[model samples]
Target: MNERTEYWWVHHDSRIQPAEVGFVGGIPVHFRFLGTAGQVRAESAELIERLPAPPTPVFRPPPAAAASPAVKPQISGSWLWFIGILLLIFVAQCSGPIFDALK
Candidate 1:
């Protein structure tokens, strides 16, 4: 029987083959090969040690005048006058019954 050896490109910490990109619940990763090993090896300590540390993320401030102040809505007095006239007409229509009830 012929025994064939296989090699995998793996993450250093997990010691498993790199998963397909955008896999649900998978770790977000950028892969860089440190070295190679025999198929049977569980871990590669030398490669893990030699691999460069991941770069630190830098924050950028937003533009100085990216946004403008929001304009507030205004009500015109004409609407208020219309509403008042409608209320006056409603009260005038009901005034006869109201006066009769008061007697």
Candidate 2:
């Protein structure tokens, strides 16, 4: 007699050890659990029978397409402005010392 081993499929392509209580698709698709070194597993027939009927796929409205190309924020301009301000502050702070040394 084959022992009924508990198994789990975390997702369509992910798996977890020690089995978890979850289901992926309406139909339990058999997949190999990577945690078990590619050991094949499937949802228990009892669990499949216990699961609520899969919801019928509904027609979802297509996502609205962008009217125009996306405009990326101009981050470089802000960086340049910050550097310019820092340079000005440094020059202002050193002007007195520089003048005194020149004199």
Candidate 3:
């Protein structure tokens, strides 16, 4: 995935089947499908100001140095607070089981 460029393509190709593509910045490009041998085509552009950017294929950051650290979820609290939460969930979950067992 090139952050500096964007690309689009049709997933499947059939003989003599035309492919339709849309771009954010420029006029949509379409290729008259010649055949299975010439079905796929692609185009790209440098990230430019005011250019409608195409949707990225994947939602992931490019690997690089100086990457921001992921935020860690904090689980710090008083022991009593932790016990209370666990007890509440335990009761809620076991209430069904306890009632079923009783019957």
Candidate 4:
């Protein structure tokens, strides 16, 4: 008779944070939920093993001056306005809580 080893990571696929994996006979295996309430199984050997290198630094042009605009400010009223408003709202919210606590 021959006996094989098997392992499983309980609840590997849940809404909870930080998925986990287990090993069986030195071979790790885990469950993954791809869709709604559906579970898919996998093994460490089956999974691709690669160490991703750090991201390369993004090259950005120097700040633009009124005279020589290195990076032209987006002239559209889309992202700039949206992000600007978001920043203002965040600052206002933060200050509101602090002011209320102080008062």
Candidate 5:
């Protein structure tokens, strides 16, 4: 069997708030949600890890933001209002006919 030493900071102190860019004792570090390993990346100054932690997962900085902007389908407000008014007209027209037929 093989065993490897791993380092992780499971929880951060309440006093030290994470930030996009910050320094710890003069060492610079950028903080962001990696969404991987689910751990914050920092210098391994402290070897101790908090209890009830997940498996020894390595933490790495998130990838740089892509230059290409994400494009999403968008609907104009005018089109939405048009559709809603049309729906209301259709319902109003249908309801009168429906009630008349039922009576």
Candidate 6:
């Protein structure tokens, strides 16, 4: 069995460990935590803002085994056509066109 661990997907295809994801009021916890801030570094805010993604698809769970059914239900076309023809014939016989068809 695979054990659940704490991780966060960053950028687009890259993931980082020892990270957590949550929402505060509405904003993401990561942004609230690791968001751009004033420090000694220059252009830090621009780099964060210029990122291609909000890391939006970041915290989503990893792809796992499909829980849905693969094959869809199938019905016999021959049987359905036969039943439909029979019904049409029976209905038409009630009128004068196929008066002798049933008898």
What's model 4's TM-score? 0.20
- By TM-score, the candidates rank as 2, 5, 1, 6, 3, 4
Residue-by-residue lDDT tens digits, candidate 3, 1-103:
2123323334333222233343435543333222234322333322123324544445697778568787876667677798999999999989998999999
List RMSD in Å for every model shown: 16.0, 13.6, 15.3, 23.2, 14.3, 13.4
Q: Measured by TM-score, how close is model 3 to the native structure? A: 0.24
> What local lDDT score does residue 76 receive in model 5, on the 0 to 100 scale?
79
Tens-place lDDT digits, model 1, residues 1-103 = 3332222244555574422221123322233333333332332311222213433337767657738777767668879999999999999999999999999
Q: lDDT for model 3, on a 0 to 1 scale?
A: 0.47
After superposing all C-alphas onto the true structure, candidate 1 shows an RMSD in angstroms of 16.0
Model 4 bad stretches (over 4 Å): 1-76, 96-103
Candidate lDDT values, in order: 0.46, 0.50, 0.47, 0.47, 0.48, 0.42
Write candidate 5's Cα lDDT for 1-103 as tens digits. Answer: 3322232342245333222323455443433322433434544233233224334438876776896689876767879899999999998989988888998
TM-score winner: 2
Clash number by candidate, in order: 0, 0, 0, 0, 0, 0
- Over 63-98, each residue of candidate 6 has an lDDT whose tens digit, in order, gives 676975688666678799999999998888776756
- Can you tell me which runs of candidate 3 are displaced by over 4 Å? 1-77
The positional error of residue 96 in candidate 1, measured at the CA in angstroms, is 0.3
lDDT of 4 by residue, 63-85 (tens): 76767848866679787899999
TM-score per prediction, in order, is 0.26, 0.33, 0.24, 0.20, 0.27, 0.25
Better of 3 and 6 by lDDT: 3
Q: In angstroms, how far off is 33's CA in candidate 4? A: 90
Model 5, position 77: C-alpha lDDT score: 82
Could you give candidate 2's per-residue lDDT for residues 1-103 as a string of tens digits? 2323234424433423332233354444344433344433454322322323423337877767776679999898998999999999999999999999999
